[model samples]
Structure formats: structure tokens, C-alpha cells
Target: MKHAPRLTALLLTLALLAGLLPAASAAAPQPAEPRIAADSAIVIDYDTGETLYEKDADTMRVPASMTKVMTAYIIFEELEAGNLTLDTLVPISDFAAQISRNQARYPTAVPLPYGGSLTVDTLLRLILIPSASASCVAMAEYISGTEAAFVQRMNATAQRLGMTAQYQNCHGAHVHYLTARSQAILVREFIRRFPQILDYTSATSATFNGTTYPNTNQLLPGLAFEYEGADGFKTGTINAAGYCLSATAKRDGRRIISVVMHSDNNTTRHTDSTALLDYGFARLAADAPYTDTAFHWSWQAVEELDALGAELHPSGEQFRPEQAVTRAEFTAMLYSALAADGQLPPLPGPEESTQPAETAPPEDTAGEPEQPAPEPEPPFADIDGHWAQAYIEEAAALGLVEGDQYGRFNPDSALTRQDMMVLVDNFVELPEANGLGFDDDGDIALWALEAAARTTAAGLFGGSGGRLFPSASATRAEAAQVVSRVLELA
Candidate 1:
């Protein structure tokens, strides 16, 4: 009996040891968490094919106007191959002209008559800035001698990038036959091909014939005017495809290209893209060698202030450019600089809050219970702050937050969750928030709650157990961490 028990104990010991040994051997170092900036987003090193971060990156959804990225790719290749030039003028074909008139599914043309002449550069500008379907068709015809052939080239290029699922029509309208997986593959392939598209995407707006065409990606201003290290790419929208954007930004010698598909609208797209860009610039490194200072760019700052200005110096001293800025005040500084630089247009007059007044309660009578005072709002200053400062100040200037009546930035004030949610609410205009299952969604006071939920669902912010602690104060670390977490979720 003693021998039998000993043998049983030895067998159990052997089995336990065997199980642990494999687990120990297979254990590898945990990989660093990926940081992403948008829902269904991706950041790729412009030079290398390495993916820095991804969220539903390979999930195929309609790319809407992002199809222009591939279109721009072909155009750029044509330019590089001497088939097209910035100044080269091309006649609009009947097919291209017809597509531009397509108000049914794509952006309508600006009454460019058939056979009207436009330069290749001008066409590029149109497609890139406002995502004109007419320009896309014209460029397609210009490249492949016909839209059919141009699509063939686009698909071939997609195949080269290992995007097996994407197929192109003259415009990026949905093909009933392709799976979402295929569409994503094609989009990813295009990204892999010309990472340089990001430079163009980051551009705030472009000028043609003395008229400035702003980027459909509104984050440009949201991040601040003439954002340093910012360039250009494009934006896309189709009712079926939702709102989409591909953005590229460079900072500290690192450039990241991010794509957001099926955003609810341009505002969501910008927030998502800004989140991704923030993460990439703050975290990742480019494969090519460079230093942090190379990514830095300058924005002009003015010291003047009124209701929207308070320069928060540690010792109440005059403002210094090198001092760290809070995300809120930094937005103001960037706008100030943009105004100085002539990048942003003149400011608009004070209007009632952009928030839905219908949702607000009627003013209380003197005898009634006192209503809570509304939070203060920021001045929409269009000055300049470079890169990081630009994003911060831009957020402020947009009335995404209320800055102190004085111009000083209180960088260390903890951001209340309600405040952050309110900032997000102010940032976007969404459809009515009801039947989404949150009671707060129906209330006017929870506007930020509604906005935050929408953004969160779009993968901009990861919710905590489906609840946003709106009353909690947000720390800088918490803010960055949340932003980073949201980037990863995106």
C-alpha cells in the first residue's frame, strides 16, 4: 500500500512538472502595446512596410473617398514616370465628365463642362483637397487612357502590395462582389505603395487660383493652423462608405501615416486621426535614421490677450515658447500663431454655443431652483504654435474647452471626465443619441456623454465597462493614457 501511494504521488508530480515545462519554454517577452489614433486605423512607417499600430486595420469596409489615395498614388507614379506633370493640362473626357456629374453616389462636379481643360496639378489638388469625383475620373482617364484601364492598373498595384481583396471602379464606389476583407487589403496595399501620400494629407489646405481649398479633414484646424510638420493626404465620404480619412504627420523626425475608415463624419475622422497622429509622434520611430529635432517645426506666437488669453507661466512671468503647454491652451497659442502667419482666415463673431440649444433647459425664473452655470468657453484665436502646441491650442480655439478669461494656460489642472466628454461633444455633431441604451444619451446635460459614446463606439475611446465616469477629474497621465488606449482601440 505504501509503495502504491508513493507511485501515485510520483505520477501526479511528473504530470504537473510536464505541464509547467512547456509553458515556461514557450513564454516569450510581452510585446509593447500598439498605439493607434483612430477607429479602424493604422500607422505605417512611410519608408518601411512595418505596421506600427492597427485597429480593425484589415477589416474591409468601404474606404469612401480614401480610394483617392490609390488614385493619387497612380497619379504620383505617373508624375514620377514623366507621363504627367504638375503643369500638364489634360482635357476632361466624356466619361470623366459624366462621373463628376454623378451626384447619386459621389461628389458632384463644380460645373466643369465636358471637354473643359484642367492641369494635372489642378486636378490633383481638386481630388486631394475636396475629394472631387470629377477630378478622380479625369485623373483616371489621364493615367490609363481610359477609366477601365486605370482601374486595372489600380488593382494590379493593389495586388503588388498583397491586397488580394480590393478592386477599383473609376471612383471608389462599392463593388457588390468584393468582400470587406478584400477592400481592406486593397486599401492597405495602396498605403504600402506610396507612404508619401501622408505628407499631402497633413496639409491644412491648398491654394489654387487664389482660392484656398481646405482639407476635408477638419482636424487640421482642430490641431491648429499651418500645423508644423503637417502636410497633406485626403478625405473621403459616401453615404454607404461613411466618412473616411487618411492622414500623415511628421514630428521629431518621425512620420506616421494613418487611415480611418467609415467614420461617422469629418469631425470624428479628425478626432480619430489626431489621436493616431498623437500616438505615433509620441511613441513610434521611423525605420530611417533621424533625430527628434528634425521633426520640429515653428509657429508664431503673439503675447496679446483678452477674454480668451492667459499665458500661464510657472512664476506668472511672460510666456516663453519652450514652456510645456496644456492641450487646451496650446490650442489657443497655435491659433494665435496661425493668425499671425496668414494661414487661418479671420475669426467669426461670438455666437451662442454650437451645442444644440433645443437640448438645453429653458432659463430658470428667479424663484425657481437655480440652474447650474454653463462652463466658460475658449476664444477662437488663430495664432500659431508648432506641432504639439498646435494640436493643444487648436483644440482650445475651437471652443472644445473653455480657457481662462485671462490668456494664461493652466497646464496642470486635472481635466474632469465630464469636461473631456464635453470637449469631445463640442468637437462633433452627431445624429440624435437615443436607444443607444444609456439614459444619459437622452439628456441634454450629457451631450459630451453622447458624443463620447459615439466616438468610443467608433473606437476612438475605449469605455470602462460601458460607463464613462464623466464627473471624474482627468490627469495628464490619465489623458495621455486614455488617448493612447483609444489610439490602440482605433
Candidate 2:
């Protein structure tokens, strides 16, 4: 493949803009906004192809082991095209075995015994899950007869995917120019074409040849800092590249892909990735429209409640469709909506202090002063002077919300999807379970199973791809829509 000089110039321009080149940083200080520790980072909505957040996203940097994502992509394409089968055994070359054993810098190397053999599927798993560099080169040679030819294919794939990256090696040992944006795009395409790759990326541990290799992507299950709904992805590290990661997650029917390149350290890569995922979810929620859309079925109900003069967000004009609703905020919105329909009593005003003013101790009863009524204890220790204190207390009084076992209502925490269903069950009579089969029914918390069934039957919530993500947090707009649906049912 012919390397483009223009690509080099573009990379140089981005490096200068990001203050990545030594001379560029020496020229001036970097900008302050979008403060991330990574040299290049980006978060994009997988479904809509929208970039939610970016910081030096286009800056060219070494991809390191992230090149395996492309390698796996090509392998999957080959599999689908009938060029390779999972059972096809690839002979372990002496060079592949030497690279695996000698590469002390790549800690994830798996011993590929020379004169032995392994299946294409197993090697692909090693390349993806543990990011084994030996497996990468072995697969490269097996597919194209030479690493040079495989490098050509990698560059061709990048070009076909509209990525402006330059790959010198198939295994990503030396410096290879790739941007965070290009990585995200590659992952997006990979997911679009072959979502089954998640099986490899999401595996917590894989056993091969009597050795168990843990996946390097720490966000997967049974690892430190495991994120809810996290599945497949990849992580990379090299002296030159620092720590890099390309992660993807799905929650509540929304999917996001994030890439962090050249993080300061391994821990920082995961932290940066977690922050990017949070930001992506927040961006999706913020960009979620209140009017007609996929959630458009709730549009009329929202409008109906609006017509009834029910004010959900007292501080905002637009209904923030994608923001997570806090426990206190949901309580307030529910109380107000119920009050509007007269299904619940009007919200009480602030109570006056029960302590009577001192009026000379009431001279007639000076010898027997009346005792003042004891003040009601605050509902939660955390909400003493909070703005939502009144709403929270009233909700507790009405039995709409019960404090957790710790005797504290975590008022500021995001209300969960299942918890929203249980809260709705308190006021409305939920329909019987209509046998709406969900793939994740067994994963639902025991306490939430009944509510999940009833809510699904009542049309209050639905499954995504046949799986009900019971633990996913409910957004502010989702809460409002559920409240509107409840009002209509009433």
C-alpha cells in the first residue's frame, strides 16, 4: 500500500493542534477545556454515529494492541466469506513462537508452542480477549502468507472503513498512526457487521492448552471496576503508546463507543474510559428529544400532562429526555402529577415550627407550662436542608417511597428502571404478567421480578433486543413518560 504524504501532513497538523509533538508543546501551553488525562480521546453514539465528546480526537498516535480490533474484523470478514472456518488449525511458525516468548514488553503473550497447532477461533480469542501479540502475528501470517501482505490488508481495511490511519505492522509493535476517532469508527463498524465479536471481547477468562488467560479489558465481568451492561472491547499498552482502550457499552436501548489513547497509565485508561462512558450516556440523555421520536409513543401523554398544568421540571423549559432522574426528582414529579389528577392529596406546604413563642410563659399557667409538640424527625439524614426535602418527606408520609434498609433514602442517586416500576406499583394497579418473555428475566433481582413483569404487561416499560435491562437507571424523560402513562391509566 502506498503511504500518503497528505496523511502525514494531516497527522502533523493534528499533533500540533493537540500539543502532542514535543516542539508543539514547547511552543505554547495546551487548551484547558474537556480536561482528560489521555492524549487523544473520543466518545461517540454507536447508533447515530454522533460524537458526544472529544479531546484531541484526531491526534495521530500509536494504536498499540488496539490493532487487534481491525485484525479480528478482517478475520470475521474472512469467516463470513467462507475463506476460513473456526475449526481450521493454523500451524505455529517458529517466528510466531519466538515473538510470543521473547516479547517481554507485551505482558499478554501466550506461549504458542512450535510444531503445535491451534484453531482459528482460539487464536482469535487470544488476539481479542488478552490482546496476545503472538496470536496477532500468527493469524496475520496464516491469513496472508506474510506479515507484509497482512499489513497491506490492514491498510486496505482502514481505507475501506474511511479511517485515515497508517499501519506499518499487523501486530502494532512499532509506531502506527491512528486517531481516537478512527478507532471508534472501526469499533462501530465491527459491531455493525459482526456483533458476535462480543463473545470474545466480553469473556472474563478463557482457557486454552491448560492455561487460563484473563481478558485485559477490565470492564468485563468478574473484574475490578466492572461496569453494568459492559460487554466487549479491547485494551492496549506499550512504552510509546502508554495505555489505550476502545470500549463499548449498551444500556436502556442506547449504545455508546469510547476510545482513549495514550493515557498516562493503565489505571488512568480505565478511569478515562469510565468517565467517557458516563459522559456518553449523559450526552445521549441530554440530546434525547421530548417530542416525536423513538420514544414518541409517550409524546401525547407528556403533552396531555403538560396541558393539565403538571410541571415536571420547575427549573427548565425543555423536557430533558435523556438525563437520569434522581430519587428526589422522581418523587417530586410523581407527587405533582398525582396531585394534578386528584388521585393523591395536594402537596403540603412547609410546616410552621411547633415551638410556641415565649409570651412570659403564659402567666395563667406559669406553674404548669404546656409541653410543645415534638418535631417530626427528618426522613433522611442526607436531606435535612436539601431543596427536595419537602417532596421526599411527603412521599415517605404517603408511603410512595420507603427508605432503604440503612434508614436513609439515597435522594440524589439515579432512580433505577426496576425501582421506578415498584414505585408505580404503589399508586396504580399494575396489570397481570402477560408472559412477555425477556432474555434477562433470570438476571432480574428477586425483589424486582414481579414489578418487572407487571410493568411490562401494563405497557409502562419494554425490553431492548428481548432483554429487559432491569438495573439500568431510568432517565428523567423516561420517568416523566411513565408518570404520564400512569395518569392516563388512572
Candidate 3:
């Protein structure tokens, strides 16, 4: 719903790979544009609300049964209003019963006996699991007096949601209008608002009035077309709508929403969604990939960073595992760790600084005219436009980064274990050395001895043979594990 944000992430990656950056940047290849057979499709990161991929997504098409997603949304709204409960027995009206009994008209309907009753919970399962049309009509009548009035609510809700849609009915029977993009947005909102809806949508089969109804969605568990983590939403195939699906799935704690409209058939509809979902999943994984980290001893720490959120992902590149952690990388990780806890104070970028240079010439000169002073050495000459510039700048502003002897940050140079302790010591008082002593304590610089002793005593460095290796360069894996553990301690 953000302005022009559609496919922005994908376009940025594409533009970067199109010779805008080094070939190595593209070494972790971006997933190719999926071969989608659907007339329109879209995929979005459910967490960021950012579009990961799209194809003719804004072109309006009949939403078909996907419209039931909204029906469920409204029903959820009504339930929250105290007007209905899951166990509330809804009356089986003449209209609803008539539609149910009319096999030619409502083939998906599980025939309801006239004047009989089913609970709102049962009806919800019937509609979601079986794509039962009469169940929708029944629920709509109970909520708004008539399905026609419910359609008005649906359209109004769509408009309120800023969806490009025109609702003609409660269930997707006759016809309705919705774009693939809008459908994705609607489902995103629906799931966000009523995540419990998944309890019903994830069901592969349900029994109604002693007749069992299998889920029309083939993406559920144990089906031939089943996709791992495939859960809720709906499917439809009217002549005009063709085969359409609005589907969602979660893998590795990340959820994605996709809509495939006008696919050739039911199988291909799932096929198109699978491709879109896979594209989305791969894109997010690339942001903080662990494909290279699994063999490392700290692989769990690397994976935990993904669960910790985007702050840990810095520049969306895999950390060099065996390589030494750099000063800039440490600064970025520390900044992100503090930020994730909302502990970062007001800090401005280098460009936002208003202070004069550290060695500025005096404003008043008594005799000779003063010439403009030469600019003082920058905090770090190498950081401008660097991939970790923002984090480094913020870290520098907070005094978390101090450049080396020549006033250079040495952003790419290896950070030693003692140096890691010094930097980390800035956040909290490193526990005093107490009685702890390492075999290599003499190798630690006098400046870092207390921090080295304290951090080692704290078990940050799991020394072997009583040697802490204080001056040895810390690997990326060690840095990540240390930082992650620090976050947990914080």
C-alpha cells in the first residue's frame, strides 16, 4: 500500500545485479523471475509488507472464491463486536436451506435441513474447508439480514482497506472484481487481523451434517499438491474467473502471501503460487543467509539472528565465517543489538553534524588575516558510502568506534578478541578480572587486560589449555555468537 513500493526490493536487487555493483555481490544469485503461467500474480513479504515479486498484479480480474477471505474477515469483525460467537447456533433460513438443497446451483453446498441449525463455528469450517456457498449466504444473512446487504459491507470494507475491488456477493459464486495485488493485500490484512482464521483455513477436511467435505485447497498437508507450511485462504474456478487462488505459507518462521489469478487449471494455480511463494521465501532468506554458516560451530547463533529480525541483517550479505570480524562489522552488529532493544539514543549521521572541525582556526585574529583552516581528519576516511556506513556512523556518533593511531577506522581490518572486549566494554562495566587469569594474559595490550580478563571470566571466550588467545583475531562466527549472547544477557 506504500507509494510506488511495489517490486522496489526486487528492482533494487535486479539493478544492483545488472552491473551496478561487483559481480561478487551477485554471487548469491537472486532468484530469477519465476515462470508464472497465471495472467496476474504477486508475492509479498508478510512481515515487512513489501512486495517481493509481481506480474501484471494491478490488472483487475475476478477474485472468484478468494472473495471469501473478506467474508471471513467481516465475520470475524462481527464476532468481535459481541453479536456472534463461534458456538452461536445460526438459524437455517429458507433462503439458505433452499440454496443448499439446490444441487445444480450450489454444488459445493452441504445441504442444510430446513429450519435446522448449525453453529457459527461449524458454518465457518463448512465454508472454508468445503468452499460451501450456502454457508456464506447463511452467515451473511445472520450478520446483516441479507447476503445483498453483506455484499455492500464487503465492498465498503474493501474501499476502506484501499483495495481495488468490486464485491458482487458474499461467496464467490456469481462474479466479483479484484486485482491480484489487491487480493494479496486483502489476505495480508485478513491474516494480520484474524490469525486465528488459520485454524479453520489450515483444515484439509471437515464434516458437516454427517457428510464429510474435503478442503478444495490442495496445498494443505498430505496432499499431492501440498506445499510445506501451506495453510489458509481459498480457491475458485468460475468460467469467467478461470482458476484463481489467494494462498499463504510459512517456512522458517517467515510467512508469505501470494495471489495467482487466471491460472490455466487448479494444478497450475498452485504451481504459480508455489513459484511466487518460493521466490518470496528465497528473497527473504538472502537477506541474512546461513547457507554458508551451517558447517560452522556457531550456526545456531547465525540462525537465531534471523529470528531476531532485520536489524541483525545489516547489509543483507552473509558474514565471512572463517574471516576475521572487521571493526565496521562489529560496530554494525553492536549498533543493531542496542537498537533491537530500543536502547540507542539520539544519534545523527555524519552529514547531520553541525559542529566545526576538531582543529578549526580561530574566528578572531588580531594582526594577520586568518586563512580558512585545513579540515581535520575525518573519523574514518574509508567509511563514506561503505555498505555498513549508516551503522558505523551511528556507532561512531555514540563513541562506540574509535579510529586507530592514524585516525582511520580500519573498517576492513581484523578485530582481535581483546579489541572485541574493549568495544563491548563500552556498553556495560566489564566485570573486574577477579581471580581469573589466562595463559596468554601477557600478550593482551595493557589497555585491554582488564576487559580481556573480565570477558574471558564471563565465558565470552571459551579458552582452551588455559590460553584465552586474547590478541588473536576473532572470527565472524565468534563475533556473532558473542554478540547474540550479549543481546540475551542484555
Instruction: Specify the highest-TM-score model's number.
Output: 3
**Least accurate stretch of 10 residues (summed lDDT) in model 2?**
1-10
TM-score (C-alpha) between model 2 and the true structure: 0.55
- The lowest-lDDT stretch of 10 consecutive residues in candidate 3 is 1-10
lDDT of 3: 0.76
Q: Rank the candidates by lDDT, best first.
A: 2, 3, 1
Off by over 4 Å in 3: 1-27, 287-317, 320-332, 335-490
Ranking by TM-score: 3, 2, 1
lDDT of 1 by residue, 281-307 (tens): 544333111122113321111212211
Of 1 and 2, the candidate ranking higher by lDDT: 2
* Backbone-clash count (model 3): 0
lDDT of 2: 0.76
* CA deviation > 4 Å runs, candidate 1: 1-39, 173-203, 206-212, 221-228, 285-490
For model 3, how does the per-residue alpha-carbon lDDT over 82-132 read when each residue is reduced to its tens digit?
Answer: 889999999999989999877566657688869988999998888888888
Q: How well does candidate 3 match the true structure, expressed as C-alpha RMSD?
A: 12.7
- Model 1 poorest ten-residue lDDT run: 1-10
